[model samples]
Target: MGSAMNPPSMSEAKPALSRRRGRIQLLLIVLGVVGPMLLATGMYKLQFWVPEGRSYHGELIGNGQTRADLGVQADEQRWQILVTAPKDCAVDCQQLVYLARQIQISLGREAGRASHALAAAQPLSADYAARLDREYPQLQRYPLDAGVFARTTGDKAVPQLWIVDPHGNLVLRYEPNVKGKDLLNDLRHLLKLSNIG
Candidate 1:
């Protein structure tokens, strides 16, 4: 009789042990799959690790100003490559203008996806204006407010390259010294990521 009772208790204990083992195995499997993912996500969110590289090369405009606010009429369906210079486009200014035109041209099959625009705080010389029209027939001209862009570019009216999205938002600004290759790389990346512009 004692042996019979012992056998029944042992049988019951076997099932309890089996269930405990199963629970532990399930917990370990969940941890194995989800642990790394959670750690990676937490690290990313916490900014504990920085990305190896950045996609865009231009300086971001923190104020979030747009073409509409500046009174520049841009194509609502295409990205804009905007060139800003002082009243008179001297050699340096002309170089920036040329850079803008070349950047648009370098887009190749996607060339039509972007449009070029020139803005000056002061009016350009008649001769230079005519030359610009003749050389870059696709360029759109706008008179920029010195006070408006001045706040962003500092006191001096240095020629600057600005990227405007389809919604007319002024997003990126690059210095005149920026390399053509850098401009191309940024534009390519923007076109790839953006469905609108």
Candidate 2:
């Protein structure tokens, strides 16, 4: 037909290439718009139902014993709050104890769903056990031997609260002088937020 159309000119070839590039750009835009929404949904599910990933080098006490030897293995399976206090509890120590007791009680319907126990950096005195029986009938204070102290922080450093999750993993440990409200808030927060193993 007119000398075979003299082949399409190079100048005209660029427009066809530009149109193909435009189609690629449009496809990329669509993918970019949809990607974030899908990612967010996945992350939301990941936030819950995750297995216990708690990895903490528990304070190296000399003789840290597990709940098994103490016959508390079953209790440990539940969401348990474990605290180590000194053999001779001071005023501040008593304050933490009181705060912990309130926190356990505040669990209300979830109280049984969780277990809280106290370990003495030193041996538990008869008086301490009696007091626990009187005030916190539900809580049982046990004598954590010296090796346990070595496995933990150390001797003479006491009254620190360690939170153990339902999956028997040590999750959070609080420092000294933390307030009652702060502890209660943390306990509530952890209980509400995590449904881990």
Q: Could you tell me the TM-score of candidate 1?
A: 0.79
Q: What value does the lDDT take at residue 124 in candidate 1?
A: 89
lDDT of 2 by residue, 127-158 (tens): 86688788888775666554545544445465
TM-score of each candidate? Answer: 0.79, 0.61
Question: Candidate 1, which segments miss by more than 4 Å at Cα?
Answer: 1-14, 25-46, 69-76
Model 2 residue-pair collision total: 16
Candidate 1 local lDDT, 26-111, one digit each (tens) = 99999999998998998899977757676778987658789755545555579988887754677777887898899999999988
Model 2's TM-score against the true structure: 0.61
Each model's backbone clash number: 1, 16
Q: Once model 1 is optimally superposed onto the true structure by TM-score, how far is the C-alpha of residue 7 displaced, in angstroms?
A: 7.2
Off by over 4 Å in 2: 1-20, 23-75, 154-156
Q: When superposed on Cα atoms, how far off is each prediction in RMSD?
A: 3.5, 8.5
